[model samples]
Target: MTMCPQCGSTFLQPLRCEAKGSDVLLVELRCSECQTWTKAPHTRADMKELDRQQAEFRATIVDGYERSVAESMEALATCFGHALELDLVTADDFRPRTASA
Candidate 1:
């Protein structure tokens, strides 16, 4: 029993099956909560826009990773710039005077 990710419900049922190829099988999935239809295929490009959207959808991980990396780099750059502007230095500048033991 596959749960419907869209509705977070486990009432999904098979609607129909279409032949994608001689060996490939495409099944249609229906959601009870949203009453939506999804086609399962090796790949599908219904229209140009839909294809573009699907491509973007599939590329989500890369997009998210790139965005996260960009954000981290920006933060690091800002911090380094701030430190440089303040002339911050290491602890070597504040060495305690050692008495002649």
Candidate 2:
């Protein structure tokens, strides 16, 4: 609920958030910037802000993962092209497997 007193950072990650009552929540947060831990009783508004921050972080992570996957696929395609040019990939590579009796 409060900024990190150690570093004045607002980037705090919730380690524990439990509903204390209908509108109050017991929150334990760890600061990302200075790794300081703090606990307090928070309101629903604080929980909403925390959820919003987490959603933004989730979106950022998903976007990064998508970009990484796309780059890896492109690299694999280029490698396949090089292999084809060098004749390292033959017709047999595409042939179906035959089972032994």
lDDT of each: 0.65, 0.88
Provide the lowest-lDDT 10-residue window in model 1.
42-51
Report the alpha-carbon TM-score of model 2 versus the true structure. 0.72
Stretches of candidate 1 above 4 Å error?
A: 1-23, 26-55, 90-101
TM-scores, all candidates, are 0.38, 0.72
Candidate 2 Cα lDDT to native: 0.88
Q: Return the top candidate by lDDT.
A: 2
Q: List the residue pairs that clash in candidate 2.
A: none
* Candidate 1 C-alpha lDDT tens digits along 1-101: 24456776644446766777765547676776787677765333333333464467559968999999999999999988898789885677579978997
lDDT of 1: 0.65
TM-score of 1: 0.38
